[model samples]
Target: MQECDPDHLVLAIENGEFERASEILARDCQNRCVCSVSALQVTALQVAAWQGRIDLLDRLYEKGAGVNDVDKIGRCALYYAAHRGNVDVTEWLLQRGGYVDAKIGVYSCTKGIPYTSLTKACFVGRKLPLPVCWGRTPLHQAVKNNHADVVRALVEHGADVNAKDERLVTPLLLAGSATDRDDLKEMTKFVEIVKILVAAKAFVNIIHPDTGTTALHHAAMLGSAEATEILLSNGAWPMYKCKSSGSTPLHIVASTGSTETLMVLLEAMLPHNIDTRDQINRTALHRASYRGHRECVRALVEHGANLAATTKTGTTVVDAIFAHIPRPLAFITEILDSCVRTTNNSPLETYDNVLLAFGYLIVGFALSFAVLFHGNDQFRDFWRAVVRTVVMMMGEYEYEELFSAENGRGTFLPITSRIVFFAFIMLSSIVLINLMIGLAVNDIQGLEKEGHIRRLLKQAEFVAHLERVTSHRIFRGNWLHPRLRMLLHSRRDIPTKITLFSRENYFHHVNHLVESPSKIPADLVEALFLLATKTFHKNDNLTGKNIEIGDTKLTSILSNLEEQVRELKIHLSQFDESEIVETARIQNKACTKKTVNS
Candidate 1:
């Protein structure tokens, strides 16, 4: 008998050349040479089973191949069979004492349930129960593949429907996320699967460990209206709060910008004031406004969302929108006007001036006693003398003349009396100035503290106001009309070259041209003309015009163009190759023109 090369046999099996592999195995019958099947080979057999080549797998098994052989990372044949929905292969291997408890692959710890071969085949509409080596049960595979038939089959076979993976994600959760059931035709099967799971008593409100989101939360997030309907009908609670964000399903819908999902959630009669907030105290309206979801904002408003809601930091939904949306001046003004008209027209005269004066008098009396009783008697005496002198001087001289030095001292008194009086007056003046300075300092500090508090309050109010206004305006702004028109208009002109440059620089260049169209320096004008020509002929070459420039200037222009191209490459990496080439050509032309005229 001929000897079989282990490598060639393994390759043949891997490539699905089962007949050739069988031939090689037959030829090496009498050599007493054994061929070891790698874990990859076992996986290949599972793939073959998926293709209905059961005969080939049988031959390989008869050739003394280890049914429980694992791959490099410890994944066995069962892992592949379960993953590919090969029920017959999985069942056969399991019956042959295949390791049904082996953990394989990255998420093995999370994939707790061991599915049977029958379950695996049922998942993808196959009718056979193939055995597998790894511990993942057929029910687990069904949920992973989102195959309703397999899931139903496994349930019939006594598979636990509520079993969770290492990540705590249940089979029901997986089915809801696997498919996009937007079209009615595609939704029927998934709807049936959900009904089956619900009938089997699967946990309808299972939350994921990482996101703390339930299956209902995921459905809302995906904008799958049909899935949402199915879940809700099957007793999936819409008000299930996400453990992480504390957001209800409606909040998730609003933030995801799923208009259909939002409408569905609203129609379900979920509590309008769910008021679920994220860690930062940002409500659904705050998220919708920040993301510029006009429809979501409108939905929230119609559902009685608090327009005056503020975040933990006192940022209102309006403030967040204004901070993000460009050219917010007109938008903000319009919002403020609307708010002013809607609010009550009561004047804020709550502070009574007479009461304030009385309070101040009481405070002054209290402060005087405290100072007199606390301080030294000598200091108190000095203060009293100063106050008396100030009052006496006021009585004798005109108040204005005392303050104004230019006024003459018209009334003459005894020389000794005047000296003593002047000395008293000087001492009183110094004390009065010092006291006034102290009061001024205190007033300034108080003002500064008050200003800080006012600024914070104003910021919070502004954010709230901006959020309210933007939310209202987003719905009323006729936004859909402009967007639809823009989308439908195919003849929209491309932006001009001048528009790409900074507005200030472009204005300066244009003004220079208008100021002295002819007197514009020949070289400078040539440079401008060259740039303009390149702009017009962006997709083509320019007409005849040659201007020689020095190497230094040419090098500078080339360097600038290179820098721009580098930046453009970074920004436009996702663009097609042809687009990148076209952009490069335009940049090169601009650089050449600038260099030639420089």
Candidate 2:
């Protein structure tokens, strides 16, 4: 028998000449095993399954062909079966211990599940179990693909209906992106899946990790009216705000151009003031107007979106929207005409009036000062009076008239008086200026002291918030970074670097400093200090401590610092004398102790 080449084998598989390929495998290639069977044979089985050749699949499976074998792309027969919706072939492969969760190609491993494949099939109106890769489960793929039967099968087979993918998007969230009728029909299956998940007590309002979007938020964002309706009917709360971005479902809907989705969201009983701003102080109205979403803008206006709302830069939504328009004046006029007519003071006009008043006051004061002391005679007289007052205040009046009679008669008297008066004027001016500057310095010092006290109070409040967040035992020794933990437990004597304080005695001493602070509330810091001290004490070398300082700990520490700073700003509002003194005393003592130790 003549040996079959790789090209012939592949051609036979592609042309569906399975009988001829089998004859070649049994006769000419019976004693010869080609590695191409693992690759080419898998492709043949996939093609057979795609062409509905059940007999071909069975014969190949019986020919000692590798069921779980992968091609160059790592896609196996089972991956093809599941992907192609060949239930019989998929079942057969699964029964043969082929990994259902087997990763496909390297590209699939990184790019995540084949959503495009499933979605395209769904668009063409095919019903098959959705294929998944990466962290996405079949349920998520089915919902994303919008395949009703596939979604149903996946859910029935115990696929996690509420399971989040790498982006933390659940199956319900994926279904919300469906736009076409085929996509919507498939999305209907997600409605049932959502119900199942809700019944299972999955968090319906849980936020996604990436965008911090909830299922309701996703539904609102994608303009999925039916999905939004289903979610509401199944007790999904639309008012639930994302924890990270702090955007509610209404905000998402109002920011979108989808009139139907917006209507569905608006009809749902959301919380009052649902169009709240996020960290950037942008309302839903701002987004709608900026995007030129006329319907969304109108909906927002009808729902009492504040037209006069301004961002941090003091630009009103109307101002921003008008500024971005190509024909600004016309659009501005149209929008202003639609606005509810009311009498209110113009902010810009008020600002101009205030600036004018300030300018007038400054010019008036300068002119009045210049006019009052224009003549040298009057100036001399004024300086003499000032000098006399200063001399009297200092008990040196005897020296005040030392130059009063330096020359004889009126001729010399005028010259002597002028010289003495000018000297007195210069001296008095210097003294008065120093006095005024001293008063100003005192005022500034008082303000600085107040600010410092406020900052301390803020630090205390931040420590309180940190204490609240790390109260759980599971979070113990896990939430703070090593540097932050070291900073929190930092002693006056130890350097900032861990390597510098890696010495057992120094580490123990620093631990004492942290423990000495009665107000330090972070358990992670305390735990880290305790563990590090104990570990280092037992073995003077600081090996393996690096592993203890995980990235999560660092992230938590940074979060605490930010939260503390914010709290300190709030604390600045309530400054007190006693609190300031106590804080100063503690800080001073800490400094003194550190200096002595160092």
Candidate 3:
């Protein structure tokens, strides 16, 4: 090896010249040499670890190489080992007193590139060559490189799985967000890394301070179904809205058009949460429809997403989808068809109206044929008269056909026949036709009025179906959450004998009669109490008993509630000066006092 080239030993180890590397390190055992490679000044031990040569690594360590020696970028040999996915070297280094949670900072003043100033730049605006790997531990590097084995080894050696980089990204978040590449093997490795970290009790819900995104958010955005499932199964909350966009994981998955991932998320979500809106009051359905994600839209609709959900500005999902000019016909057709199916009754009802209209046509034909049969020879045969009336009703024949003498000698018809002909024309052409149109118009207007109610009914039907399916033996306890399963099977757990309510349950049952269950104005509370008191007094007079209000405990509770109502009235008067407020206040006071006296 050349003495002038300090990188000779490192290059020899990289090229599988382990014999030469061993000789160079053995001869220079008193001083371990460092080499400048790829703008990073790394020691020979770091090179051996990066190359995965345990023989050369052991030789360098025997020559008194520092286990925690950092390079120009502040990364140690263990960082390189983990970065290259060298599991054996990583394990050996850790066993030999290597720091497992060592953080690396890439900024240095020796590079002469405003290292301190650039480090202070925001992540969005920074235009540096290297990423901001400051504060990133060896585990972060391993997870970022998609090295599952290295990640496992580092984590086993007590690596900080939740350690964050300078950008506030943990190892789990980095692994979940590694979606720049589309390689299948890389994705598998990412899943493995995520599984290992989560198993080690990594914080799955750590939010990025800058972007307000968690590991679940990143996994949902990437559409990684396996990673998302693992995170959710490990207690990652799906309903936590991002602070920046105020969107949940469901919204992100829908916007990305990930149908499989969206299904996985839907399984973990509740029914009422399906239409949760973000900061702009836009639901996942709104995002999916706007992006023209047909499969996602179909899934959302089938899972009971509200088609009529609107934004704060009153824009609905339909309005967002149709806003595109030169409209997408297939997408528009899909949305319209879904809306009609969910919101309208069966078309069979409309068809019955049409059938009724056609029945009236037959009656008009019989009436005309009966009267005209005796006046004209054209109507002498029943079949011929039927054909003539049908043609005239369709406007295919001239009016002269009825009075002309060409077909079977009729200069003119009798007065009775003429009257029947005029009546048939009026009934068929004017009355029956307009009546059919009126029925269609009425049906359409009725659909509009009952559209919202039908949508709710469809959702209820879907819930009922889901409940029935989940109540089966196979899915009884294996599929749903424990709390939901308890709710579904609660009736089965009840005993044969009816039991009286406990003291707590009894108090809860009648608690609302004393005051409003939720926070509301004092006027409504007063009205409720007054109504209850009057009902009790009336029942006492009718039943000849004072069982409802005879107890001293009940009277004292009512009196205390009346006092609380008075205080609430005072609070309302301080902020509201409107006439309606004053009226409500006065009415509340009089009602409360009257109920107390009674």
Q: In lDDT terms, which candidate is top?
A: 3
Question: What is the total number of backbone clashes in candidate 1?
Answer: 29
Residue-pair clashes per candidate, as listed?
29, 5, 0
Using Cα atoms with residue i matched to residue i, what is each candidate's TM-score against the true structure?
0.43, 0.40, 0.49
Error of 2 at 426 (Å): 89
TM-score of 2: 0.40
| TM-score-superior candidate, 1 or 3 | 3
Residue-level lDDT for 252 in candidate 2: 73
The runs of at least 3 residues in candidate 2 whose Cα sits more than 4 Å from the true structure, single-residue gaps closed, are: 1-53, 61-78, 85-144, 162-203, 235-248, 269-271, 320-598
**lDDT score, candidate 1, position 422:** 54
Evaluated against the true structure, the overall lDDT of model 1 is 0.57
For model 3, the local distance difference test gives 0.72
Which prediction has more favorable lDDT, 1 or 3?
3
RMSD of 3: 26.2
* Candidate 3 Cα deviation (angstroms), residue 472: 57
Order of quality (TM-score): 3, 1, 2
Which stretches in model 1 have alpha-carbon errors above 4 Å?
1-8, 25-36, 39-44, 50-52, 58-78, 85-138, 145-158, 176-196, 320-598
Comparing 1 and 2 by lDDT, which wins?
1
Whole-model Cα lDDT of every candidate shown, in order: 0.57, 0.55, 0.72
lDDT of 1 by residue, 1-598 (tens): 3227554555565566778767776786642223433322233344444454667667766766666765443555554555565666666766676655454444323133234322332222122233332334445665666566545555655566787555666767766555664655435556666677777888888877877888888777767777788778767777777778788788788778988888887777556554567778888878877887766776676666676788889998778665654334444454445444332222222124333543454344333322432242322454553443335534443335432335223323335434544554554455544554665666567668779999999999997776544433344356558765454332332322221122344334334222322333434544544543442221122112112223334456666767766775564455555765676678779999999999
